[model samples]
Target: MSETPEKSAKASKSSQAAQPAATDKANSAAKPAKPAPKPKPEDKPFAAFINDDLLPALKQSLTERHQAPISLELVEGDRPVVGGNCWMVQGVLPSDRRFWLCFESDSITSGKTIALAETGSDPSLLESFLIDEKRINLALLQSRLLQRLNGQKWFGGN
Candidate 1:
């Protein structure tokens, strides 16, 4: 039983076709796919970020912790310590405890100053915080502020 040359040629052509497809599949599997680039976040002004994003976040955090929403407002006046104009967010707790969160400058790269005081009295807990300006966001601000307050035992701890 001798095989025909035509059948042999046909088998060879089919094998050749299958070989390339298999190689293509293997090559594709071997190479890693490039990842999609992450989208760049929109840069917002310091004042807008505070007023639109930070104030509400802080208020919500305080409300969740203290069971009453703290009043927060943006104020522009002389810095309490340096005597220069800056942005400040004043928060008044339900129990009459007051706190001031101040920025050293209008830029997001600036440092921060925070003070916690009783009503009608100077601040008893004053602290300065340095944050990564490039990565500043609502979550970071809220975390730092809450951490600072907790450190000072502001929410009823002695």
Candidate 2:
């Protein structure tokens, strides 16, 4: 038995309305489950530079004529000012300049240390002797130390 046009139209509208609800149900069923949260990067084993060998080497290198052995601290985990896997070398110089060197690598990238004389003189000679590619070298540091030991005055010398 064929229905009247009005009844057929009403039936079609109801079926159309029901179709979206059925599709929604099917889509909800087909979706994959939610993924778990990822682990933090700091949870893994990170490189540390304050090992036995490195600490002594750094302390010896940073020590000055009158200054005591520099203290080394390993800054691990989250610290706003300090990054992970970083080392902080703090010491007081003979001239009273509180020096703080923040080594931000797993290994020693640069082994040189440069200091300006107290007089604030031209640092060109010092720079030329100390810096190579804007990095300090061992020879330059040794030379500077020797120069300091002698009575001769260099740039920024007292």
Which numbered prediction scores highest in TM-score against the true structure?
1
TM-score for predicted model 2 compared with the true structure:
0.28
Candidate 1 matches the true fold with a TM-score of 0.64
The digit string of per-residue lDDT tens for model 1 on 1-158 reads 87799999999999999999999999989888778775322256777777777787788788788735457888888666456788888888776777778887776557888878765777754577655456766677779878877776766685
Name the regions of candidate 2 deviating beyond 4 angstroms: 1-50, 58-64, 76-86, 92-96, 110-158
**For model 1, how big is the CA root-mean-square deviation?**
5.6
The whole-model lDDT of each prediction reads 0.75, 0.43
lDDT of candidate 2 vs native?
A: 0.43
User: With candidate 2 superimposed using the best TM-score fit, by how many Å does residue 65's alpha carbon deviate from the native?
Assistant: 1.1
What is candidate 2's CA lDDT for residue 126? 21
- Model 2, residue 157: distance off in Å is 4.6
- TM-score for each predicted model, relative to the true structure: 0.64, 0.28
User: Model 2 over residues 42-107: C-alpha lDDT tens digits?
Assistant: 223333333443444444654544444424444433212322333433434344433233434433
* Cα displacement (Å) at residue 30, model 1: 24
By summed lDDT, the worst window of 10 consecutive residues in model 2 runs over: 122-131
